[model samples]
Target: MAETMIDVPGYKAGTWVLDPSHSEVTFSVRHMMISKVRGSFGVKSATIVAPENPLEARVEATVDASSIDTNDEGRDTHLRSADFFDVETYPTIEFRSTATRVEAGDLFVDGDLTMHGVTKPVSFELELGGFGVDPWGNYKAGATATTVVNREDFGLTWNAALETGGVLVGKDITITLDLQGSLEQS
Candidate 1:
């Protein structure tokens, strides 16, 4: 049996490979300034390198743009069109961490996010879910991170004026990530 040790500061120094089967990247946005629409994107690959101080970990991830699912086929199709993600032109969304820090028991990651041919700096508050061993004996670590961004910043400015005087879609988008990673024993 392989044992994984997690120190008091959290995280073990090693390679952390995201387990996509148990992880997800989700987002939500207001619909017409009234209701909210939620969706998730399939992550293609991800990696996290935890040094001696886990707070300064380096991270990188890639998501399949065309794999977005909002539960509504029509809406999903529209989102994949040029008006939004334009998956055909921009098939992948990526993030590369520039810095990481811990404050008041919370971890924050600042990174450059590129989507739709636009790159922007974004920060996400991370909640570490601790490390454990799965039933199958694999060492696992989990965490959740969230951030909000303006769609227009990414050139996703498509919208429609509603009869009620509001736009068809909201500009602010909330992105949430539920990550489960496998710790590599070096």
Candidate 2:
């Protein structure tokens, strides 16, 4: 038998909590002029709300900076040091959505992202993958979002120059968000 695709109804205009167990907040950046390095920050909590009568929504997310893990202790320590995230002074990275727009079935979340003590506006283009009741009797929804940001914009500009005349680290970082959330029915 062929696999069947289920079309789920769009999310109801209301508040939804992010299920961390099923959601991952990850990012990738160019490293050593060779390849890209990837990492994920553990999310503490997040909430999103959409009003029934409006086309916009609000989102707030908090991430634990100390949870940065790139599979290497040395690199992780360096990232948390003053040269990069400076996690000692700034323990959390936060985002609060200012506006949301839907285009071609994708949701663009425009928000203020605060990292390394600097706040900047960023947009995450998201697709509402789908939602439904799971076999275990839980309502689940999924979304995928992608965005790019300059490290300098968030005050994370530490880098070294290579002999070949290029910086060791790239300025632009690509962030990919694969989120699976559960609805808490009231």
Candidate 3:
């Protein structure tokens, strides 16, 4: 097994730019009370700024709402309508960090997440997998983050009643982020 270390020289603190081709922002939601529907946003951008020798960092990101896809055309269209994301009116879901702290080898980033014109506070638990220089000589860093949010809170309350006395979908949506960024040159 390959052991990954978090510590890396020259990456202690600075600005990093996300390499979109190597990063992914995905989410999953419980559907029909039996299984999960997984999806990902195709368009996203983020930036991270770390202070020198500091154990914390700041992050900001934006995701294009219309880019949501779950491999079903009909469902994707529905999600873009008022029944769910309503991507027509709200084109983007954004996050801006207010505070960040590390606990037990994980990074907790507290930020405000805005969706469907509604803003709420949320936290993402992040794990710094490691940092290194890629074959092309670019400094690379990897991290994974996750968080859960109530769909109702973001005005995504669309639901259907199942015949079995339960709703067609769950209120809580779990978002998982696998991010890779490169250190920016001054």
Candidate 4:
């Protein structure tokens, strides 16, 4: 398939910096083999080196591990403990793109995700939300990306066996990124 379909209107070639106030990182995982637990983290920073062709962009981002919020103080604290993120030792989660390509009319970013002191390759399906100019005269762009990863793969293997024939926390997790940024012409 042609990469033409991946084009974004009003796109600019430059270095893009994430607007922390407008970007978010969220995730959900099955809990107790029944419901799901959703939480969010603060984006420390994100940047993209976009060329004339958006597909050639290189992306790098950091997430504050200690910023996890799940609407429950107890759970949040547990998530920050050694059983999970171990924020004291690994205070940040990072992702850096290795490649970008269009597949079946969708954009995919291949990257390495580092979390809990472990690094592994992952792919995020990206959807460009287009580009536009902010009221303040800044050129901006938006996009959403998502991927699924196994918690154990990152050394987050803590779990409890449920007498009901399942586990306390599911193995797989769904992660999503909602990003909006301004372009700095190179």
Candidate maximizing lDDT: 4
What tens-digit string does per-residue lDDT give for candidate 2 at 1-186? 321222336666667789999888899998876899999989999887756633466789899998998999999999999999999999999999887776555557789999999999999997778877889887777888889999899999889999888899999999888888776677
Model 4: residues >4 Å from true position, as ranges?
1-6
Cα deviation at 65, candidate 3, in Å, is 0.7
Superposed by TM-score, candidate 2 places the C-alpha of residue 43 at a distance from the truth, in angstroms, of 0.6
Model 1 bad stretches (over 4 Å): 1-10
Q: Candidate 1's residue-wise lDDT over 28-110, tens digit each?
A: 99998999999999999999998876656899999999999999999999999998999999999999999886656556889
Would you list the rank order by lDDT, best first? Answer: 4, 1, 3, 2
lDDT of 4: 0.93
Kindly indicate the candidate among 2 and 4 with the higher TM-score.
4
Error of 3 at 98 (Å): 1.0
* TM-score quality measure for candidate 4: 0.95
As for candidate 3, its clashing pairs are none
What TM-score, computed on C-alpha atoms, does each candidate reach?
Answer: 0.93, 0.90, 0.91, 0.95
Better of 1 and 3 by lDDT: 1
Query: Considering every candidate listed, which one attains the maximal TM-score?
Result: 4
Q: Output the better candidate (3/4) by TM-score.
A: 4
lDDT of 4 by residue, 1-186 (tens): 547435577877889999999999999999999999999999999999988877788999999999999999999999999999999999999999998989887789999999999999999999889888889988989999999999999999999999989999999999999999998854
User: What Cα-based lDDT does every candidate model obtain?
Assistant: 0.91, 0.84, 0.85, 0.93
Clashes (N, CA, C under 3 Å) per candidate: 0, 0, 0, 0
- The CA root-mean-square deviation of candidate 1, after full C-alpha superposition on the true structure, stands at 5.1
